[model samples]
Structures are given as structure tokens and as C-alpha cells.
Target: MGAPRRATLRFTSIAIGVALAIVASPAAAFCRSTTCTGDCPRDADGCKTTGKQLFWPGVCVGVSLQRDGSVNIPIADVRSVVATSFATWSALDCGGAAATISFSQLADVSCHQTEFNTSAPNANIILFQDTQWHYKGVDNTLAKTTVTFDAKTGEILDADIELNHAYNELTVSDTTVVVDLQSVLTHEIGHFIGLDHSPDPDATMFAGYDDGSTNLRTLEADDIAAACAVYPPTRSGKCEPAPRNGLGDACGASAPTTSGGETSGCAIAAAPSNTANRLLSLLGLGLALRVRRRDRFRS
Candidate 1:
């Protein structure tokens, strides 16, 4: 086998958004995340239009909340909020039928590291960075969602959410909140499921977030439309939520260990892409197959 390699991209740019009144139908303005970046000149709303639309090619996807929630919030509270935030999307009404997509919350994982293991089992993790914010613009950026996907088919392989609790106050209450945790998760969840920032300001997938505002806790018309469109009721697939090879809570090749300490050789074929307050880029790694990383930033 070839030696493993790593590639890192520096994200220090700012993506500023100015909220504007919508002149078009709000339901018609939702944006889908593509394999291309924001610079791609395809979507007229400055969303994505030029590349393959990113999506999970299955009916069910698995999600794992890090066992260590956050230093400022209780683990139970974090679990509850995370569950509710994802549930909100799973139960979307697509014209009397449920959307084709569903999520299975695998047991809380001990792995807090954000990565896609090419030669071992993996988990789609949602973790809080309470000790340090490792990205640029620590003060204004609230969170980031990193999606690992197949560039050729636009199929999502693994996704992870990192909350910037180290630099900002994240609250759970409905009133007098500093930064509502549910709102942040819900918006990030959109990115997790392959939705981009919508042109409509009222959408839960909007690019800009208002502090202390819980408006993103619920989906708007645009969000609903986007969900139904992406995962229509007639979409054909089974509800298998296990991550690529299987779910492993640890951070490396030795994950899901037994007495024999065996590991699988299954690697997800990919190319790198990103998204952030909201950074999204596509990264290319030197691996056997092309692996892409996608990320989105929240402010």
C-alpha cells in the first residue's frame, strides 16, 4: 500500500452577506450545495449552479453527537438539542408525505477529531470545540460544517460539525440567548444534508445569522421546498443509516476493535470541498482515489 498523505488549506477569507427583501417567491429560492465553490458562476442567486449538486445517495444517513458535548452546556442538554435539531429536518412534510431522507442517531461517539478515515470505519460526528477555536475569524464565526464527498457523483460520504464555543457564548434558551445552539445546528444540518445558503433571508438556510435570534430553529417555505425537492417522496432507497463501512466511535484505524484488532481496507473514493461566518471550499487530497472536502461557515 502507498504511504498516507495529508493536505491542508488555509481559510482566512471573509464572506459577508447583506440581508435583502425578496422579490421572487420564497419557495423558489432555495439553493442546493454543489461540488463547486461560491465562485462558480452557475446559480444566479450567488448560490450553486455550475457543478454536480451534492447529496447523500441513500435513503437514510447516520449522525453521531460527540460524547463530550461542551464545557458550557450539559451533555444531556446538548444531546436533546442535537436530536431535536435533526429531527426537525427528518420530519419535514413533503405534500402530505415525509421526505425521502431519514437520519439514525448512532450512539454518542468518543471521537472528537474531525476527519475522514480512508482505511477504517468512520462516523459522521457533531462535536463542540470548547477549548480552542482553530479557524480564522474566531470572534464572529460561530460554527463550521465539513462534508466529505465523491466529486464525480456528488455523493456525501462523511460529515462533521464543529461549534466554536471557545470564542462565543452558545445558549439553549429561547429568550436572552447569546447564540442559540439549536439555530446553529439546524442551519449547519442543512449543509450536512447538502443544502446551500438560500437567497431568501427568511430561510433557515440563509447565509447570515442574527445573534440571539431563534428564527432558524424552524424551517421556512424555502427550506421545506428545498428538502422536498432534494429528497422527494418517490425517491427509491432503503433506510440503512450506518456510516460507510460501519459506525466506529473512535478516531483512527483501530476503531471498533476486537480481540484480534482487525481493521477494514475500505476507503471512500473522494475529492475535498468546504463551506463557513459561512467558509465553503473544495480540497483535493493525494490518495488512491480522489477525496474532496466540503465545509460551510456560520457567523
Candidate 2:
């Protein structure tokens, strides 16, 4: 074959190879729906499944106590929980408005006991025979609680504190402090949101609790990505531009700023066309193939 014909054939072969690889990749497949259970490795199907629960998109706004002696959990902690939990969703491409905990406004807060109360009869209790407490007695016990919120508004109307007094029964070691607070909070926060027990023991959202260990601190990419998807920042960040009526600001323009006695506005522009050049090159390969086929028929 002539050099020109050989080059054309090579180009066509390369284009076909590139297109096939793109279509065959895993990302081309739509994710399957499957629930993750205790200790199971994330799979394409199981990882993609999400709960039907809908959360309101707004910052966690308030935390305060009621007239009663019961402690009111801070909305800031609730905000942190939402931030950490929805982190998974944001990493994924799933579309939704991001949820936030707003501290801007004060709101009424209340608490109720849901489990393991020492005051109640027949309550399961863990007694520490020794007076030795770890980390100023804070690490001595592991307590868990759930505070439910209104669907429309991310308000904490009630909380249930579950305490494992036996936490005090364990001997204090160097690893205990690091593991106790991080693991427990990560787990309880999982429940605070809509996630149920994950069958994967290694997962931070796992159902059963383990002793002092740092394994749960790092969230699985799937979990965080899923949470982010539920509360996407894109939809959450958009706000209607303030009306120009009686205001000196320009309509549909960014906030004005005075620098060196000069006004400036900020705007975004589209990126330059690198992909367009690549597409044109690919099309040229197709044209070369057609020309070669026509020459072969003429011969």
C-alpha cells in the first residue's frame, strides 16, 4: 500500500479503538439499586442506592434550652451532623439542594429520654466499680442519642440520649480517647440523619459499635459522595438577584465594589475550546477513512 493509504488506515484504526474504550468503561453503565448491609464491600449496585427521605436545604439555625431542666442539644451540633453526613452526597453527582444548619436565628429547643435511663427501673446499666475516670470523666462512658427534626424545617424538636455506662468499665489506654469520641459521634450522627445500619463493619455507618479504634473516622467515598448528591451545593447556592427598584445596583449584575475610587463587577466566562479541536481531529479521521474506501473501489 502507498504511504498515504497506510496513514489513513492507521488513523481510522486509532479512532475506532478510542471510541470503543469510551463506550465500554464502567462509568458508562448506570448505577444499580441495592442496599448495603453489615460489613459488605461497596458494589456498583449497592453503592448507588439512596433512601427516600428528603431533608430541607438550609443552615442549622439554632440551639437553646427550654424552661424545663432537660438539656437542649445545640443546633450547631445538628449543623455539624448535617455537614458531615451530607458530605457523602456532595461528592456524588446526584442532584439536590444542600442542607445547612443555620445559627443566625434563635429557636426553641427541647429534649426527651429515649433509652437507658439510670432513673428508670429495669434500665440496662453499666457500673464502674473503680473511681478511675479517663479524660476528665468524659471518655468514661459512651452515650448515643437521636434528635428528630421536622421534614419541612431542619428543627430539632426532641432528642433521645442512649448511654452505655459500661463504657466506664473499660480500662483507659492511649488509644481509648482518640477512638471513643470520634467513632461514637460518627455513628450517632449517622442515625441522626436517615441512614440505617450498614452491613459493612468497616464502614463508619456500620450498625454495631466497636471499642477504641480509628477505622471509622475516615468516611467511605461512597457514603460522603451520596450525602453530597442529596444536598448539592449548586442548587443551594443560587439566590435571586436583589431587585434594582430604588437601589443604585445594576440588574443581573454582580455586587459592585469600590477600589481606588473605581467601581468593578465580577463575572464568569466559558473556558477556551480545547475539546472542540479534539472533536474536529476525530472527524478528520472519519473523512480519511471514507476517502480511502472510495479509492479502493475505484481500483
Q: Say which candidate scores most in TM-score.
A: 1
**Superposed model 2: Cα runs more than 4 Å off:** 1-57, 61-143, 147-161, 166-174, 177-179, 235-299
lDDT score of residue 76 within candidate 2: 47
lDDT of candidate 1 over 1-299, digit per residue (tens): 11111212221111112122233432466778776643455433545557777788888989999998898898888998998999989957988998888788898899997777666878989899888866644555577787777666677778888888887789998877877889888888888888876645556775555555677788988898888888988888878898877888888675332222111111111121222122222222121111122222211
Give the residue spans of candidate 1 off by over 4 A: 1-26, 254-299
C-alpha lDDT score of every prediction, in listed order:
0.66, 0.30
How many pairs of residues collide in each model? 28, 29
Q: Could you list the CA RMSD of all candidates, in the order they appear?
A: 11.6, 24.6
Top model number, lDDT:
1
Evaluated against the true structure, the overall lDDT of model 1 is: 0.66
